[model samples]
Target: MNDLSGLLGRVGERKDILLVVLLLAVVFMMVLPLPPLLLDILIAVNITISVVLLMMSVYIGSPLQFSVFPAVLLITTLFRLALSVSTTRMILLQADAGQIVNTFGSFVVGGNLVVGIIIFLIITIVQFLVITKGAERVAEVSARFSLDAMPGKQMSIDGDM
Candidate 1:
């Protein structure tokens, strides 16, 4: 009993363990058929985390302040992919995605399929732009760092002779 308690306490302190579990569970979700209720909860959680990440980016003073953004973003992307696959399976096998998706579909469509398609395209474009902008910023920072290090590297080589 004490050993089990110690293992649980260690897990609580180790974020890597949680991340591993999340990745493993996401893989499992792709193969398993999740009930509509669990899918709804995961969808809501993903949206909430995305919103929080957006807020963090908006308020950050520098890119370095959120150095782990890329890893977090990758994890979220995997999560979204897993969710999309799972949702597709549910729709193909059972023809239902859950209440939130149903509500979103109705609200987005509002009786016009054309309008819904247009809205979806616009949203997709906007998402692509946002992701590309972040990628560009990361590239810029990396280039600047490389340039800044060049002088030090040159000096070291010159001194070695």
Candidate 2:
């Protein structure tokens, strides 16, 4: 149990470091040459989702809470599917009209869409599962103690003291 606690402490430290790195990356992007609107939108979306997931990971006290991780995964997959389908439709229409370069651009954009989404979803699920499992282990260890006065029966009073 001590070993497990130490391991969890290490994991928590690593997650804190990663989160700091993520924040630094967001700051770096703010000063880069990229479009400000796009960067802001992406940063806002990522930060909001990260905050919500981090809170969920901390507050939800059981392994079952990890199940919510898949809901986020599923939402991301659906977004990817929508992006893929819409981009495919745009590419096909452009191709039928002989717009070759635009079609190729669309293909390039859509080709990696699903792959990126899959990779991100996998990473997110793994991280959340680690957090949730550690939390569950801690809960299990702490839950072994009981504070009730009686083991199997209530105290009874007799008529005579």
Candidate 3:
């Protein structure tokens, strides 16, 4: 029990270091040639991360509760962009991207390029207009309330002094 607790404590303390290492690995993936199996695994991991983020946003009680969300969002965005670039590179050079892309292109898109593009655009717009806009409004309201409360906070400090 003591050993387990110590291991957990050490992991908790080094979360930032782990995050930095993960970020570096994501950056390196853009420059390396990943095997198809590894690429497929990474793609599945990306989808899982997106689902987790969506669930977190849905269940969060307040914006402040997830103060680190913006950084997480940025990192995920960069990670996805890196994956996109790497996938494109693989396709252009090797003429074979991976099973994930091939499956999506064949099964989801059904070889219909225009339909796939339209679906992609619609998802992007919905994400921007619904999720991003709602979050922005919540952040604005939170900031306004914080500013409005500042005077009372100042008064309390003055009284304490």
The model with the greatest lDDT is: 1
How far out, in Å, is residue 46 in model 2? 0.6
lDDT tens per residue, model 3, 30-148 = 98888777888888999999999999999999999999999999999988988888888888988988988998889877888899999889989998899888999999999999999
Ranking by TM-score: 1, 3, 2
Provide TM-scores for the models: 0.74, 0.24, 0.65
**Predictions ranked by lDDT, top down?**
1, 3, 2
lDDT of 3 at 83: 87
**Highest TM-score scorer:** 1
* TM match of model 1 to true structure: 0.74
> Candidate 3 at residue 40, lDDT?
80
lDDT of prediction 3: 0.90
Error of 3 at 60 (Å): 1.3
Question: Residue by residue across 21-137, what tens digits does model 1's lDDT show?
Answer: 999999999999999999999999989999999999999999999999999999999999999999899889999999888888998799798999999999999999999998999
Looking at candidate 3, the ten consecutive residues that score lowest on lDDT are 33-42
Query: What's the TM for model 3?
Result: 0.65
Q: What C-alpha lDDT values do all the predictions have? A: 0.95, 0.57, 0.90
Tell me how far the alpha carbon of residue 113 in candidate 2 is from the true structure, in angstroms, after superposition: 32
Error of 3 at 24 (Å): 1.2
